[model samples]
Target: MTDLHRRNPYRLPVLLLIALSTVVGLSILWEFRLEAWVMHWLALPYDADFEDAERWRFVLTATGFSLISMLIPTIMLRRLIANTRSSYRRLKQAQAKTETLATYDSLSGLINRRIFMEMVRNQLGLKRPAAVMLIDLDHFKAVNDQHGHAAGDIVLVEIARRLEAIADDNGGVAVRLGGDEFCLLFLKFKHQTELGQIAEAAVFQLSAPLSSAVEPSALGATIGISRSWTDAQDASALLHCADTAMYRGKKDGRSTYNFYDSEYEKQRRAQADLELALRRAVEADEIVPFFQPIVALPSQEVVGFEVLARWPKPDGSTAAPADFIPVLERLGLIPAMTRSLIKQACRAANRWDDHLRLSMNVSAGMVTDALFPDQLLEQLRQEHFAFHRFEVEITEEALVGNLEVARQNLSKLHEHGITVALDDFGIGYSSLYHLTRLSIDKIKIDRSFFEPGQTDHLPMVEAILGMARSLKMQVTAEGVEEFHLPHLPSWLANSGCNYAQGYLYGRPKPASSLFCYTHSSFAQQAG
Candidate 1:
């Protein structure tokens, strides 16, 4: 207790105690003095009584003062003890609040990832089926890009609200697993199919656009499901399965759900092997370049080649882009593969006649990276290749996110003499809108238009071709396998498309085979 506190109004009790004790002691002393006087009077003559009374009064005053002094200290000590107790309670409450904030997510007020997963472990002893669903936002990056981070924050807040609504009253808990990922645990469910439905309902609630502080926002989710009783004999195994299911959801396209399966595990192992081999193939310099001839219409002479990426394993096998690209992208190893492919293709383009051009593929992630264009230019210069001799191909889906960054970066590349072509033009969101913003040189028509309905679909194809022509962009047709050359050439020419590349011309092949075969045929024609 400090001096200031000792003097606080709380000390009034001590002061009163001291005052009361003093009065009581004085009364007692007075009574005792009277008794002494009485005793003296009874024993002796009356004349000496007055003298004795004065002496007794002095003794009474001394005794009263001593009694008060003893009581004062005891009262003060009791007050000090109470203050210590009150302060201790307040300290404990503060500590408890601090711990709660540290372990729980502030936005949702749900248990944090650290504690939630621990709960999963503790559920194992109950032996009842419990499901863990990892819910991830489908287009969260798009939301972040379109609106600012503040707007994105609102979307997350709205998501938390929706989660609260969907929480089952019977059994289960919802937790925010940090940033756009949430976890739901269902204690009584043994089957994944049942769990998946519950997860989907929870995620689907966010499909309706959410209002944000900055702007109206929308996001979707993919759920990865794991069940304790169905998936594993133990907690760790169940969690691993759930984690695997989450990634599977990410792959099958977002805004969807998937359950982990033993079959998927086998395929996952195979996919892993292929990815490793692909990386090794990249390192061993086993990846080779192939080109599809892009001929100028009317002239019918090959003016350029789109540099095709090919990965041929040592076991006399080949992997298609579909088989290996998803893995590469997931691993963030596409950039390295892309770098290697670009240099090899650029070198080949340089070796060819100056007129022959090469178009390299660019992923969306690569295009927006500030360092990407510079590094590419550096590689081209290092390889002694001219930028004008190259065109870069990007799929519409690849350019889906981060439009502004992509537009600016791509514009820079275009200014530096690299032509841009949007590949698989019709397969992704709003190709025409993309074309309006992006400075593109060409559009490759999706091959689906070519199969089985060419006559019926002629008008749609004509419209697509016309759209490209209005933008002053060249059009290339893919999947021309076994088509009549005379018919395709005439029809495409009539529709304003000038380029065609598919198996009809040649499958992807080594440069040596290309040089030996296509060049020889051209020479024969010249002769």
Candidate 2:
């Protein structure tokens, strides 16, 4: 096709033919060796013509034919060479694929656990205070239950991607340990686990907030970290130690990570046993509700009581809400707790004076539950507690989700004349906006508003007061333990805040103890 190939296409054949013709001519002529060989071989026992033109032509043509036969093989040789090269390339590609899968997790497609261990083992000599974290998704079983297994599968995959981004570079490595469990090899603890500097760089690529789509607590993650104690170590011991530390974090109220401690490790083991026991106690009716009276501020007169849940441990002291709320929620006992408290609180409300009210804390979700509405109505009917007298306290952050759905649910309660209050009013970014939108009757100022030496919140507080006044919503200040309160009754009076409930008025006391002190003190003095 090219000039060189076209010019030399017959070069080998031409050279072969020339050599053959010369040899034939030389044999016919009187050259010593040619004459000797020709006479011996070609004579063949008969006197042959030394130079017969036809015989000469045949001999020369036959020699040329032999040379052409050898030259024909050269054409196929180039194609064979090309094919062999292509085959070699494909073989290399297949080998590469085999090597890739060896170190990558088949499920999440992140690095596999074996490779992770190998990396740590190889790099331990770098000698820095590195941390390896084990993270397990909290309440993964319930996610499977409420969202179905397919949704749960997606959750795990997305979680893998998120963690991969966090540890994709520098000293970090993210490995999938299968299921909802994962490990992050922290090359440097330069920032927080997921929200730190490296993770922030990765968040922009995701369409939805990673945490919220997964669970109620908003994709809260628990971390456990272990420091390599020995100057040198193998990967097996590092991973094992890190994993043990992680289990401790789960025991210490998941959604937080814990560093390894021998004393804390023992506490965690005992705590795991306690969590198992607590699950059974929830079934056995060992958890119970206790009431503390929330009295009027100025008069110190008991007007209503707030219900607090308790688990009567065999030990004399009680387990605080902080200790067990996470456990109960994780164990799927919140629904049971909700049911028990509703029944008990209604019974007490029925026995109380007609003028008094009862306040009970509920998960924001309890309001929408199909059974919740009917069960609550039945209790209210049985107790004859005026629908107007009961108040439901929910935090500001709880109200942000599904506001339209919440409005509809609240409308049903409003139809029964029940009062709903927003607790922790100023904590959320959109709290005031939500207050105006929902048909809430009251807002409770969060206790943080009263912390000593805190300043520069007058404008925000004033704006909140003005908005509540415009809507005719009553404001109740909580956690005023000091003798001198920061916000006055006049600003509250001007803003339509009517109730103040905290320790400054009176500490929460049992109903039996509070009843006698209340009536003679001016019939729940104008709060």
Candidate 3:
């Protein structure tokens, strides 16, 4: 049917026309008879000699009234049909809008995950060479948290536009897979090099500064590329390959692209499995604190212990913190893990001498948490742990992003009589700044400075000692292996380095083993 008939169906108009035509024809056919009957019934004059003009006028008036009465219903029906047609059109438009919304991302106007995956499945069925890339924005949550989500949204929109343009130019498809994550699918690619070049271009484009109302922020993108022929034959597997590569790109540092490799994929699967196991370990309280003694220099007497997390497998082998800590941080599980470990450490510290301090490392997320100080204090209180005997160790890297907030949190810890130590000092760019800005009570010189044959680093170490002395902050020389102790120069002891900790002093021991050294004679023997 044509547009007009579609808008207003012919059935209603045809029925009304037929009814109106029938009424008019019948009225005309019996006009004189009906008029005479009406006049006789009303007892009005119906003389044979009546004027022709009067009689004709009466007949015409009667026929016109009958036609008007029939046309009223037709006009009403026509109006009802027009209204129904309008509502139907609107309903269809609304449904089309809803479908568009379901398939497209509202913020970026890119194809959503569902539609993109469907397209990928179709492409995979062709069994032809193609490339899939996963793109993730690095440190995007910081932008949203610092500048507000509006600024983050602007950045996302800009990145989406760039990706869409690039994909269109290359005859590819771009999709937003969620916050700060996107996917690009290229159905026709000659070689991996072509895909690599396209991925590189996307990274470069995304690395540009994003303009926002709050402020301009520098953001970088990491892209992971996977080829259909080499990576996988299915859509889900292809996307997984790309995702795995993207994470590797992130680990290698942002603003880069990485192609899928079997080795990396294997490592990725292992890491994923380890993460799952770690989560279970956290829930089951399998993560325990192992204490490494921090000794007073020269005397070799244990004055305090630094608590370290150890995840012991069922087979009695322990997973190294280096292997699982990053995963915890990435998954935002560090805060919960830290809280659990802190309580355990505080309880264990109760078995030690009041003068022997217990030190625990604080993750970046914990320090940023506004309630961290309160939580720590509450845990200590519940454990009946003395605040003065507790030290909180934080890395310089943790305080990089929000220095003011970290400083505030550190100040609160200091106010509660808890010692704040800067762990792995002299490594990060903001070391000096942290020393000046934060209320740090101790600085642990990194082990890198203590490596043998590194006389060049002695001067820097001495400088760090001097700076710490000037600030009246205690200093700990770390990485004091047994082999290096004899080679340790007298300056370290004389320069007022308050403590030393490493394998030389003793490896990290469980709380049960540490109890063996709790007696006063152990300190006397070591001294």
Candidate 4:
């Protein structure tokens, strides 16, 4: 039983003692001249005959009624006091629970962001030697996605336990900063090397595979360490520095730790500014499609043009794809950008010869998306582009990333007469598996194999051509610059390379130049 329940037996005794005390005190007061004062005040006969039976009975009755009235109120007041005490105890418990809920994570039982920041501020004000380590679980979403959220929760709870243990060993505090992110605050650390050791331990401990994880290999962490005195002057700044370092660790391939560096902060700011600018540029349609001719081997007849993105700047210069393409992918703008490019490229291709086709690159994310093929078809239909005239160039990495999704998307494209070519073929792993299994129409040999004077790749190229011919799929040799032609064209054609494209034909140009280039004699002369 609770304390309140145990105290119930004392309630009645307490009430009885209070009543007895009141009665005794009243009797004492009456004996001490209080009765005489009361009788004189009321002008009552104090010296009246007490021996008379009728008068004695009247006085006895009044005394009995007075005692009864006093006892009743005393009993009520005692019960009231007991009730107030019980209520106060309950209130204290509830307040404690509320404070706990507010200051700590309900699942992990660790201090939350609010309490963590407050504690950090106190430590800083005291000028105590301290450090903060920010940890992010790598590929944590796969746990939720594949094993269900229940399993994900179990994994998170386990991680919190490990973090708490680490913090306890180091004389620090562990915090759940929400989701898969956690923080450790160390107040007793003496040097940067001590913080690094702790961070290394954190990465090693957190990266250990969990029983509840769907992909055990994916269970890992990236830790970023920041010292209070050197990294920042305040709690938020310290956290930001750690966060910056954490992302840097993730960028450097994860399962690692990074200490706060001023250079990383500068790069982070620059990337942020560029991301903002790229978002605006995409929304404004400043990034447009440029066409590079893809010619049939030997004949050199322009078969189609591969669409490349070119960002036209305000100063009449174009931004390089190397500068902006990665940013687009990071911002998740590639899908929208790809769709827009498709429509523009289709419109431009319609102005060229009817036989010429248009091909555009799709990122791994786009290929994995279940809705991308349908969306691409809808865009093509809106532009009055024939399915046969549209092609998609996907990298080998996309194929290996998720074979099932890639198969589904490629199947849909093939069903609609949309060509699928595996781009940058030789650089990826398991190239032959994709070629034999997937319903691919063509394979574009990566440019690396075609670098001038690179005779060592010639045998590899021949092997790829032989494999393509055996599989009854078309082959396109990329990076056919002037240095590699006219001998390269004849050699590739003899080796069964069905198509080629490079600067020798023409650099990627505006839509207006595509028609003239297709009809130009230079295209035929390259044959």
Candidate 5:
């Protein structure tokens, strides 16, 4: 212990008591002793009988001294009391302010997640009917991106005000559960329809334009509601159910609301399972690249292979790319998975004829990464693979929100002789616009146009081929799977298309299969 603390643990209280006693003693002595001293100085006994004039003088002098002594101490004591009360009030105010900071959101002036959870527990303890509405703001990031974070904060504050007003009308409480997410707890409600109406009103209120100063496009909310009896009785479970429903609403289309449904929960669990399996698959290297040949139409020469992801099961079956690719993209696992696949494919392709190129597809999320091009180049360097022997295939969706970043990254790759192909072309609304902006070396017409029963596919194909020719970009007709028909290959070759890829050429096969094909006479012919 420090010497100061060691001297006296209650040192402050002890000194305070001594000071109070000294003040009291001094006041008592001044009121009594000082007047007696005056009497002694005048050589008069304080209680002695005297003539009328002398008695008046003594009485007035004694009363004046007593009044003066009492007044001084009384004023000091009153001042001290007032200061103590004032200090106490100020301390209380500080404590209340601290509590407010702890329990409420400073930006929105609503209860924070901590307080919301506590309130949920309290309501659950009461065993009363209540519901939790989870609200997620749609396109909130776009506002932050386009206008700046200060504008986003203003939007959140205004949203909180509207939510608070609605919660008050419904006898509920509103909470800001961190960025762009909020919750409402309804303690009084009759039926599900009432909650639905309240949710609709909330959506409408939140979607209205804020002011003339800030013009953001379609800032809205998606609300998911869960009840005490039907969905969940506990706080965490209730929130989970509401979150599941909210996500479903978001996936279906934003700016709407959904009530808790068992199907959403099931899907949530299934997705969770798939995500776990995919993570394991990525870690265990079970997800590998299977190459499908892209052939020069009419010549039937294998120019390159489009690398596809295959997750092999123990039963010799494989999971479809459609089933797990979206999960990988959503979990931000695409870059890691893609990197692994690139390493494996590059090592395999490095042993193949140098004339053959490997085209690998990248996810939309991967294109947004500023360092992705450098990372891929570095991986190729580590594998001793030439940049010109590799190609990147990205769907039109990859160019949506990250056009500039994608352009920058793709340009870097193109500079290093890595070709960039706009995959799934003619499908997105802005494919033509993307072709003009991005560093696109080729365009792959979407396979959907060539599906069976697409009778008018010829016109669309002709238009795309004409555009590609005008731009001096190579065209690849995808899903030309009917090679048995002699006219299909001739039509594609005569239409000024450079390549075609689908089941008609060959299904995606393993690396070991390529070792034999590379040695065959057909491989020499394609070469």
Candidate 6:
């Protein structure tokens, strides 16, 4: 009965009906005979002369009247109780729906940022050690660009499902913290090692290819981990720490996880400052092109120039290309910077001898632009630069994305009489593949093959030259810094390399310096 009452809280009305029915029965009995005796004892008038059968008839009539009176109120009360119960149930359901909307992501069905933070704060209040992770999808923008936002959404939803499963298995909470980023909170973690294991699992799981209608490519994620006891004590601090580590992971080439460290944070801030300065530099046109002479082998005659980028600081010193180019790429400023430098280079190169060519490096971002060839050709026409005397150089890294796009862009360049050269050959795994696939006119052997004591690379270099010869392509031996050494230049010349460029001839200089060098060198050779 107690269990039944607990299940059905409306049992109070039924108990009241039972008590009322018993009272009605006893009242009927009193009217039958008991009330007559009581009336005589109290010296009141009583109907004792009536027959027994008449008295029984009165008992039944009284019982029927009492039951009728009780039945009306009981029915009304039951209806009222039932209505109240229904309203309460609907109210509870509405509250649950509101709570779901407020606390969870509508798309992924994972906890949203606000509720995730609340959970982190509650865990902190309990003084328990925990781990917080920030995961960022690598190259997600490319996925969206290549396959459209619908496909990207499918990938995100699948990733969320996988994360949710992992969280359930580990007793953790997963959150979709907007866009292609997610957060995981692991409670009562005993050690950082365990946290690392969980993070690796997440990385592996998220890296899987999504089931999308667009034939989605494999995706990778970078994870950043922070422990509450070690990295931070509060929710915001913990998230910040994890975010810092996540960016570090991205900088280190993504698809991995990094633990929060003070040193990494310091480096991250410095990189941030550099990125800001680069943006300003590009806007101010502080970035300029410096020309390096590419000399013909054996004769050492200046044939053409390669345009290199240099960032001139306020102190009149130049920032190293190695220092700023990667940052520029990361900031998505490479395309803009390339455009500016190309315009300047073209205008300067137009003043050179008609026979001399000018070569400039095209960044990966630029090649990925579908309209890059058109834009470049239009810029060349605006500068009145001859397309036959221009070349664009790209490395294997430039072809890492959208090969078909790269090939199409190169084809457009070739059709317009511009030369394409594959730079830094032998450094990438796909160098030979690229050579076979792209319509390249030249292959520039990387500097590593020319380093001293790397004699083992000589055979490979010979093989590359042989391959270039078979394909009727020109080969440039880059990084010829030891030209002064006896027999080095002659050895390269004898090895069938047609062109060379390196510190041995001259470091990269301004266009004016290069023009003077070209003029004086040709005059000397003629004399």
lDDT of 5 by residue, 1-527 (tens): 22443466576446555655565556555444665677889998785343557645555565556656665775676577667768988999999999998999999999999888888878888987779999999999999899899988988988899999999998899999999999998876459889899999998988898863666988899999999878888988889999999999999989999999998689788988889989999988889999998887667778788999998887899887887888887888888899989999988988888888899989888887898899989999999999998999999778887899999999999999999999889878998888889899999998888877675888889889998999999998888785435667688899899998888777898887775244233336435
lDDT against the true structure, each candidate: 0.75, 0.66, 0.83, 0.85, 0.84, 0.85
List pairs with backbone clashes in candidate 1: none
How many clashes show up per model? 0, 1, 0, 0, 0, 0
- Residue pairs with clashing backbones, model 6: none
* Candidate 3 lDDT by residue in tens digits, 452-511: 788899899989988988899999999888778566734578877888888977899888
The candidate, 1 or 5, that scores higher on TM-score is 5
Clashing pairs in 3: none
- What C-alpha lDDT, on a 0 to 100 scale, does residue 212 get in candidate 3? 49
Instruction: Summarize candidate 6's per-residue lDDT along 113-188 as a digit string, tens digits.
Output: 9998888899999998778889999889988999889888888888899999988888888899999999888887
Task: Give all TM-scores, in the order shown.
Answer: 0.54, 0.50, 0.64, 0.71, 0.63, 0.57
- Candidate 3 residue 452 Cα shift, in angstroms, is 7.0
lDDT of 6 at 228: 92
Q: After superposition, how far is residue 525 of candidate 6 from its true place, in Å?
A: 11
Ranking by TM-score: 4, 3, 5, 6, 1, 2
- Score residue 439 of candidate 5 by CA lDDT: 93
Q: Output the lDDT of residue 247, model 6.
A: 87
Evaluated against the true structure, the overall lDDT of model 3 is 0.83
Q: Which residue runs of candidate 3 sit more than 4 Å off their true CA positions?
A: 1-62, 84-115, 126-130, 133-189, 197-223, 250-256, 279-284, 293-306, 325-339, 349-377, 387-506, 514-520, 523-527
lDDT tens readout by residue for model 1, 1-527: 55544469567567666766776666665555555587676896444345646656766676667656766775677677677767987999989988897778877777778778677777777665678777888778887788878777777777877776666542777788898888777767646556656776866776766665544444678887877656775666776787788788878777777787878978888888977887786776567677877766645566677777777866787767777778778888888888888877776666677777887778889987878878888898999888888888988765677788788888888899988888887777689898999889888888877785466766878998988878898888877665556687668877788887766666676677656224333324335
Scored by TM-score, the top model is 4
lDDT of 4 by residue, 317-406 (tens): 889799899889878899878877887788877777777789888999899889988999998889999999988999877876788988
